[model samples]
Target: MNSYFVTATGTDIGKTFCTAGLLRANPTLSAIKPLLSGYEEEQAESSDSGQLLAAMGREATGANISAITPWRYKAPLSPDMAAAREGQSIDYAALLGFCRAELAKGPTLIEGAGGAAVPLTPTKLTVDWIADLGLPVLLVTGSYLGGISHCITTAEFLLRRHISIHAVLLNESPQAPVPEAQTQATLERYLPCRIFPVRRDAGAEDFRTLAL
Candidate 1:
């Protein structure tokens, strides 16, 4: 059962891109993002759920998206706030149950929302869910300025909680201040795990190494 919880230094840092690449590079693998924010059901094909579905060679249907992401919100905010907009909240127990059921299917990558510390609920956090699941984290980060700080900070936070990190991926942003290789080199000194570089125009072949 090769499973990993795909998390990132922060939101829009390419967690979906990296995760989708891995899934595409490895057809046998499966992925699920149980909680979603800023979701527009009508435009499912361009959404994160759609991308992941496409990567897995599946249809981006409403039922398909609903199967992977039971909780979807329209507001582009943290789960706590997004759900609040709908007069609802995260049911941690149900979320845990959904993850557990999905993980049981094997070779799954659970992608978390926002950052590792994003609040899922008032008392429950994204990291708390990762810790509870006891899965190795595949951290995704960007190569922009201050990326090193963001990556290291998140890694340390995971380390402090004794959460094992499978690998750190540096997603190269367009016109990044620093080269992604340099960021990977810098992160190697701090993160006690392998670091993979994701180019801006990289395809599935570029991620084959990490796919297996």
Candidate 2:
């Protein structure tokens, strides 16, 4: 089955937004955000899990979000810290097991909690978990100030670890410091991977080639 772990250079860099676009582009693939921090029950319809469910042609209801995401923390912090604030801790093994089970079922898009290096457990980095999963990555970055450096640095780190990068998606950010074309060109020069820009309202056809 074709699967990928979607991550980003940092928080609010449009990982969910990009993932939703990819889902809209490819409806057959199932999407899940197994671990989520800063989640409030009242905002279920606007949360990352909710957005993912929407992209999959499902309604963004409490049950739907919870079904896809088992671990939800209220604190808007890293998973480890967020879980701690509520007197809870993430079972890294269980989390891995859940993802493995999902992958075994079929093609799945597993979205990470934060940036590539964010700590899921106090001892495990997000990238480390990605490596453990052994799936290619769909990295989402933005065209904002310092974005060029952030994207290149992230790609370099992943490559050094021998992680296969399916693609680098350059999503537009508000008040971008540099044009999207320049950033994409610069990244293409340094990384041996496919680079594409995604619009805020991108359709399935827009991501048709990369969804494969």
Candidate 3:
């Protein structure tokens, strides 16, 4: 089965949205957010974990959500800081093992938290985790004012490390200075890869072109 590590330019930038769309389009595709920060059990249905559950046609119950996303933190911060707040730390080996096992189950979409540089532990950045997994990335970025620079910088960092980027999803951000098309064009110019524009409030059909 094919597996992809879904990462993004920053937190709340549409990694989950892009992933949910793909999952909805292909119902058989399994997925896991694996690690999450800023999770509240009371508002389970509104969180990213809940959204993913809905997309997968699973009930948004605590047990169901936890099955896919095990590492959850209540604080809205990077995993390193959030884990520190709870007097815990992520075991990199365990995290890698969990993802490998999940990927082996089927065509899984493994989603990540925060930005590429955001630390999962004291010394392990998100990029390091992606590198260790050795999976192609479904890179997601926003179409905000400084989107071009952020996309280019993150793209360069991954490409320099020889990470295969399966595709780039330019998720539309609200009240942006320019249209999403402009952002996609700029990224295409700098990045030698396929870039897809995901409009604001896009649905599952909007992402079918990716052939998920």
Candidate 4:
């Protein structure tokens, strides 16, 4: 089973949009937001995984959503801290098992919350989990203001850690100061990896542009 994990430099980047793009490209694919903290009932209206399911035309059924994601936290913070606040703890093995199960189903897209090095457990880093899952990664970086440096630094860190990045998605958030096309050009000029800029309103066809 082919799998890709989408991670970014920070929160509020277009990781969800990029994930939706991938799902749109391959409707049969399954996705995982294994640990979704910061989940509020009101915010479910704008939740990442929810939007991804919608983009893929899948109903948020119990079986489908549960099969893809096993953990859901309501605190708007990193998993470790959020779990602490809620008197809960994250199980790494359980998360790995869910990811393995989803990958077994078909080509799966695993979306990482926050950035690469955010804490999953007190001692374990998110990138360590990414290493454990051992899937090729796709980075979704915001391409405005301070994007170029962030993308390059992230790419360098991934390289240093020996993670295989399939490509980089230069996402233009709705309120980005600069136009996406221009940022795309600038990113292409500096970054060595393949960069694809996704629009704020991108759908399936836009996602299909990535060869996975």
Model 2 residue runs over 4 Å out of place are none
Per-residue alpha-carbon lDDT of candidate 3 for residues 135-157, written as tens digits (9 for 90 to 100): 99889999998888998899899
Q: Rate the local accuracy (lDDT) of all candidates.
A: 0.92, 0.89, 0.89, 0.81
Cα lDDT tens digits, model 1, 109-160, are: 9999999999998898999999999999999999998899999999999999
Ranking by TM-score: 1, 3, 2, 4
lDDT of 2 by residue, 1-212 (tens): 48999999999999898888878877778989999999989889899999999889898887888778999999999999999999998999999999999988888999999899999887898898999999999999998989989999998888888899999999988888777888899889988999988866677778876746
lDDT of 1 at 148: 92
Summed backbone clashes in each candidate are 0, 1, 0, 0
Q: What residue pairs are clashing in model 1? A: none
Query: What residue runs in model 3 are displaced by over 4 Å at the alpha carbon?
Result: none
Better of 1 and 4 by TM-score: 1
- TM-score per model over all chains: 0.98, 0.96, 0.97, 0.91
> How many clashes show up in model 3?
0
What ranking emerges by lDDT with the best candidate at the front?
1, 2, 3, 4
- Off by more than 4 A, model 4: 42-45, 175-177
Residue-wise C-alpha lDDT for candidate 4, range 59-81, written one tens digit per residue: 66656565556777888899898
